[model samples]
Each structure stands twice: as structure tokens, then as C-alpha cells.
Target: MNTFLNTLNSNNMQTKKPFKNLKIFASGFLMLTGLVATAQQTTGDVVKKADVDPGTTITDGAVRVIDNKGTIKYLQTQNGITMLSNTTANVTTTTWQLGGVLTDSTFIDIDGKLFGLNGLELIDAATESASTDATTESDAGTGTGYTILVRDEATGATKKLLATELIQSGQEAFTATLAQTTFALTGAPVLPSFSQVWVYRNGAKLIANVDYTVAASTVTLVENDYAVYAGDIVEIQYVK
Candidate 1:
């Protein structure tokens, strides 16, 4: 009987009322842990403001260049450059404006790449080809006044593209002057490269260099060759 009474007492002790505060204590501990986690930097931390001023930075292998007004930027490996590029919204050609001129190496670096201006030659010719339609490659369209520009090496004059294949050799003419053998040419033409000189005297064709020698449009008769006298009809034609 004493053993039974002892077992019953042990059972009552084991079944004693559970404390309500324990669950609350555990709940408060989880809440406190959450608050602590919010208070401290755990992971993926981000700073709202930085201590340095950052300019412009592009990512390189490890680090790149950057600068800012507030602080000196990190990684000043090379200088930064700003180039402006402008174009029509849907145009294929883009024009780039550099802040300043670049060196030859710089030009080569930008122009000689695989996808750079490889096929295009120097812009020595400005007028469009005859085979090409007038509407093509035109800023305004049509050929009323379109002229290609080519620098005349011999004459040192800039020639306008006349047609699909020809140019206006600065049209030069000299009227006859009686007793005068010399004539002056305008400076704009630069008068050096003429393939042929036709001299028409008294409505008749005169021989070249034989009758007169011409150098840069300074016409002078052959020595003692005053065949071209005063009031003679003379027409000088220069063809290049």
C-alpha cells in the first residue's frame, strides 16, 4: 500500500500545472532575436551614403577608373575621355566629335579595327557616282547643284565634280591683244597642268610651242616670232 501511494504521488508531481510564462518567454526570445538581427548587419548590407566621391567608372579586369566631386575615385589607371556622337535617329552613319584632336596612333586605334572604316578610302572625291541614283547619298536629293570636290594637284585648285566622271578644269580663256604676246591667268586656277594649248589666230589654228611658249598661262611668243601681231584674232584654248 505504501508503494502504491508513492507511485500516485510521483504521478501527481509529473502532471503538475505547466507554466504559461514559459511559452511567452520563448516567444519573446524569438522576437528579441529578430530585433537584434534587424539592428545588426547580417548579410547583403548596403550603405546609403558613401565616404568618397566617385566620378565615372567602367569595370575593367579587376578595377576601373572613377571620379566624383565629393571624393577622389578609385583606380586611376588611365584618363577618362568624353566624346559626343550625333546622328539622325535612324541613320547608319554616326559623327563623333572629340573634345580635342587625337594623335595618329589614336586615329589608327579607332579607325583600323576589324569593324572600323576599313573599306572606305579617304574622302578625296565628294560627288556621287553617275551609276548611283541622284536620290542616293544625298543630303537634300537631286543634282541641280551637287558638285564633288577634287583637289587638282597640278593646278592646286579645288575642282567641283561636274558629272559622273569629269570635273570643271577652271575654264581659262584669253582674247587676242594686238602686239601683246603675254597674258595673265587668274590665281584661283593655279595654272600648271594643261595637256594641250590651242591657239586660234585670225580665225585659224596656230601650232603649239612652235608659235608660242606657255608656262603657267604666261604666254610668250617664240624668239623673233612676232607672227602674232597687234589686232590679230587670237583664241587660246586650254584642255587638261
Candidate 2:
């Protein structure tokens, strides 16, 4: 490559016209292009995926190799250290944790009037404790060791959504166990407005002021006439 450039410079020095044969210039240019391609191949960075130590460093310009553990990983940096790792990894994860879709479920733009529900669909939960179905919902927010976090745009603070949040979607009933006062609502934090709530006793609807107070995940009866006795049936109705 240097010899080719020197030949061009020598030809330029010899002639006031700065003349060089077209064949020689073309040959020299092609040689230079080949040299450049070789240099690029030798010096360029490469990425490889294989297992490595925890604190391994990947150079900025090199091919960033990931420690492949039979799973795909995204390149990330932490405390100015570069690594290939998972972005969505949790310290501990549950089977029923909420997340974005992995593979897309079929989305037909069927409006609210299809089967039965206007817009909301009924998710079937398993009645048994061990079965994890669509309806095996956990209401214990505080005890579940997981929290739903929401960020405040105005204050720029992240906080946990209250545990045991229940929103009644439709009419439902539950038989209160013997001596149970505060019935853990099937859905919870209580409905916003009192006008939407209706609590019923055996066959008669209980009075609002004198009967029961609906709070988050609980329906507390007044314990007088409205008090829930042993094996008393309670019915609740509310909008979604």
C-alpha cells in the first residue's frame, strides 16, 4: 500500500502536469481498497456469547459477548459496568405476576355486546387453594410480598398501590363463616360512592345507615340487627 502511494507521489513530483497513467492509478486504488478491507477485518470488534465470571467487563467498541445461560439477554450497564443480562429479572417472581404479553393473544375487535359481559370478561378462578387458574386471585396485598407501584407525575415519587384492593364488577354473594364480623370482600378497597353498594341479609335488603359499612375488602355489619350471625348469608351488589 505504501509502495503504491509512493509511486503516485513520485509521478506527481516528476510532472508539472501532475500526470499519472490511468491504468497505474486504477491499479493502485484497487490495492488500497483491499488493504483497507484487511485492516477492518483485523481490528474490528466482535461479540460472543458464553459463560463468564460475574464482574467481567466488555469493552465499549469490541463485540460485546454475553454470558449465555440458555436464555436470551439484553445488553445493560449498571454502576458504569457493562453486562448482558435480563431487564425484567426480579429477586423473586410468582407464577401469577402481572406483566406484558409474551406471545400476543388473538385480538378481535369485537365490541362489548358479544357473549354476555358488556366489556368486562369473567375470569374463572379455582375454588381449591392449590389450583392456579384465572380466578385464583390473591387479595392479600400486604402479605403477598409483592406490590404494584405507581409513579406520581407531579411529585415524581413512586409508591405502592394499597394492598387488598377490591373493585366489585357485578353482583356477588358470600356466606359468612360462623362469628365472622368483617367479611373480607371478594373485591376490595370499597367502592367509591355509597350509592352503588347494596348489602342484603337472608331474604331482605339491609338498610345502609343502620346495617353495614363497606370498606376496602371488608363489609362490617353494625352487629345489632344487621350483625352477621352464624351461617348468615350476605349478598353484595356493586357496579364494576
Candidate 3:
């Protein structure tokens, strides 16, 4: 009876040890689960509070800010909104204007690149000043009238004219003597006066009773004005 009691006691003790170990393992697992849940809750709260709205304006006078780091920004105007900067700016009804004249500087347009006007006189890169005045002469002279010479810088070609006035009264015979130039006549077919001579290249109307002759590469236009007042257009044009 004593031996049997002792063995029973030993088995009970072994069983109690396994139950204690199981209790300890269960407590540790609960603690680890609680810690993980707390960390997840804190992370969720941080994410909710860190969210922000995007910016709207990019450039206003001096300030330069973008809406998003990777997304494209836009510019808003009275006409419409546009995507600007590295992207395209699609505007509506509004055109950009350069308030001041740009001198001695180049500018870029929608076409990529272009030249600007410079110097005392506005001269474009494509076209230049045709002639420069040397000296003013009297309207009356032995050679019909005053002479105005136009020189082309590119080709070194010169055009000369005997500037005579247009008279409305009695028949006035006006003549234009060109140096090494011939003009093709069309329209009303009238001769050109001094002031009207420039109108030739200006693309104006030609009057009547106009006679032209080309000799030794020189051209002369004779006009007999029976009627017609000053400022009446009588022009002609020449090539080469």
C-alpha cells in the first residue's frame, strides 16, 4: 500500500509540471499577439494623419511651386487653363504678347526659334532697309527734277530716278530716267512722277499716256498728264 501511494504521487507531479509549462507558453503567446496588435494600430493612425491635399498654382509673378512631384502642373488664365512647363500649355482664346520691343536680341516662338528686330531702324533678319537718303536736292533741275537713288546692300544694285512733281493744270510731261533698270507696265498705263515713281515698286496703279523706253539697260518713262491731280497714283515695277 505505501509503494502504490508513492507511485501515484509521482505521476500526479509529472502531470502538474506539463500543465504549468502549457500555461506559461499560452501567456507568452498572448503577450506577443497583444504587442503586434498595438503596433498595427499605431501605424494605421500615423498613415491617416499624414495624408495631405495637392497644390493648385504653379507660378504667380515670382512664386514657383508645383502641384505634385511626378505629375504635370498647369497655368490658369482668363481664357482657359493650360498644362505648362515640360508639358504642353493648351490655352483658349488668349494669346501671349510681348509688351516691349526686343532689340538686339533673339526670341523663340511656337516654331522653336526666330530672330528679333534691332538697330535705330527696325530691321528684320529676313528683310533689310532698301535705301538710305544721302542729300535732298531741289525739285527743279536741268535733268527734269531731283534724283533719288536706292541701293541694295546684298546685291550692290542701285536704282536712280529723276524726281519731278505732278501738275494738275495744263499738260505736264513727266519723265523718269532709271539707271540700268527696265520696268514692266500694266494697269491704267500712265507715266509716273517723282513722288509717284516710288509707287512703282510699291504696287500702285499706273496712269495714262505713259511711254517707256529701255536703252543700253537704262529705262526712261515719259508721262503727258492732260488731267489728274497730285497724290494720284501712277506706279510701275521692274525686275533684275
Top candidate on lDDT is 2
Worst 10 residues of 3 by lDDT: 46-55
lDDT of 1 by residue, 1-240 (tens): 233224335555442221233245345535533422423344694333221122222222111112223332221111112222122232111111223322221211223446334575543346633433344344544555444567667855545554644533444456656567776666634343334666566666666767767786565555354555656656666655
Q: For residues 54-140, write the lDDT of model 2, one tens digit per residue.
A: 223232211122122333332211122233322232111101112222222222223465633377534334432222222223444
Relative to the unseen true structure, what is the Cα RMSD of model 1? Answer: 25.2
Residue 109 in candidate 1, Cα distance off native in Å: 8.6
lDDT of each: 0.42, 0.45, 0.33
Top of the candidates by TM-score: 1
TM-score of each: 0.33, 0.29, 0.15
- Residue-pair clashes, model 1: 8
lDDT score at residue 62, model 2, on the 0-100 scale: 17
Candidate 3, residues 1-240, lDDT tens digits: the string is: 233225336556564553464456445544533422422323333221111112222221111112223333222211111222211221111122222222222312325556445564444536533233323432333232234456556754454643332232112222334332244443324543433342232233343225444433233444434233343333444322
Which ten-residue region of model 2 has the weakest summed lDDT?
89-98
The whole-model C-alpha lDDT of candidate 3 against the native structure comes to 0.33
